[model samples]
Target: MERSEPARHRGQTAVAVVLRVLAAAALSVDAVVHARLAPGYQAAAPGGLGEGNLFVAEAVAAALVGLYVLIRGSRPAWVLALLVAGGGLAVLLLYRYIDLPAFGPFPAMYEPVWFFDKTLTAFAQAAVVILAAAALILHRRTRRA
Candidate 1:
């Protein structure tokens, strides 16, 4: 059975919209978690560029990217969202398992424990990564076709 062009287009649009909403929501969660924990982290690990400040920065970036994706589910938006989520997730996991020393202006953020906020942020970041990757793929295919 062959689907009509309009039907196919509608289906694609629906998928894109759903992906955009999910990705944006996940990013929002990540932003909120980081912002909420920034103050405590800053007090715990103060440095030239305190970990709390870093968390705040991440929260801002996540919020911006999430907004962009919500407004425009374009390829570029997906790329930015992917970068933010992937970078945050990588840093979180690295710090969770490894105790790396701070270089330059960064603080030593090494925590080998999984708490509520940390776990929530991790899950949200991971969700954004997956959703953004899928959106990118969908956009790429749509463009090619």
Candidate 2:
């Protein structure tokens, strides 16, 4: 049992590293996409204060979260990482599949289209969500152990 401890530790470290890298890469992709789309979205907006600004904010948030997780591997970092990913994923999935009506102030967000931007964002966001969630679970398990 003692002889295999080092190997187990190394394996766990490798898995954690892989998860971090995966989550970071996905966040980067999504962030760039949002940044690229922001100007166009804002330009086409009714008052230039709708989805476009939201995109910019999301881009910044994603970058910060990604950088934080990529640089530091901690349970708190993982929790934040998953929260951002999960929130973005929820919005994307909802606007993709659901025909949501307009909220109190927000316009109806029923974008049932799958262009290159949408496709890339969905893929990257999904990856980030999955990897972040996995990393969080692994972290919790390690803490308990």
Candidate 3:
């Protein structure tokens, strides 16, 4: 299949791709900040804000995904986005299940607030991932048909 869109739609695709790249970059930055600045941050520890290796992994993955989106178009981008989103969801769930209670003072010590923040961020990431994936899939189908 040609997999091409109308010229008018091309602009929209470009914008979407740029936005996805930027979003990935922003996430990478966030991970870096958490890993480097957050005190007591440990990958293995429950309460740690961020771990060095994990943050590096996420940043690298995100950067590569963003690059692929920009250079190769939507399908690969969608797959990478899904992986990134799933990772976020996994992190949130892990925090909820094991980290929240095991390493925390519960609702005290600002743990509850942090938990809510992370949860919301994860949800937002998942939403973006779903939207991008859907857009790519729909575009592909339309092009094929």
Candidate 4:
């Protein structure tokens, strides 16, 4: 059975909306984790660009990308959201396992603490990536059709 043009469009829109909302929620959760973990980074990084500033930067990036996705829904927005979430997740895993080596002006950031909030953030970031990727695919499909 073939869906009517209008029906198909409506279904696509609904899917896009649900995916967007989920992406935003996941990004928000990651942001909250960053905010909470900012203080702890001090213990790990200590006297470097570690504690307050870096975490705030991460949180701000997540929130801004999430908001941008909500408002714009453009390809670039999805790309940026992907970079933010994917890159952050990569960093989290790196720092979690290997002791961060001081590179350039940055100090070593070896934070192996995997508490509830941290775990939540990791899960949320992963979700953000998945949702953003799906939304991007939907956007491209809709555009082509």
lDDT: which is higher, 3 or 4?
A: 4
Candidate 3, residues 83-116, lDDT tens digits: the string is 7756756765565555443344222122333554
Each prediction's number of clashing residue pairs: 0, 0, 0, 0
Candidate with top lDDT is: 1
Which candidate number would show the highest TM-score if scored against the true structure? 1
Minimal lDDT window, size 10, model 2 = 41-50
Q: Roughly what TM-score does model 2 have, to 2 decimal places?
A: 0.88
For model 3 the TM-score comes to: 0.56
Which TM-score value belongs to model 4? 0.91
**Residue-by-residue lDDT tens digits, candidate 2, 20-116:** 8888888898899999988877765668456778788889988999988889967777787778877887898888899987676555667888899
Report the Cα lDDT for residue 127, model 1: 95
**Residue 19 local lDDT, model 4:** 80
Which residues of candidate 2, in runs, are more than 4 Å off?
Answer: 1-3, 46-48
| Model 4 CA deviation exceeding 4 Å by range | 43-47
52-144, model 4: which lDDT tens digit per residue?
A: 667788899999999988877778988998999999899888888999688876667677889788788889989989988898899989999
| Candidate 1 Cα errors over 4 Å, as ranges | 45-47
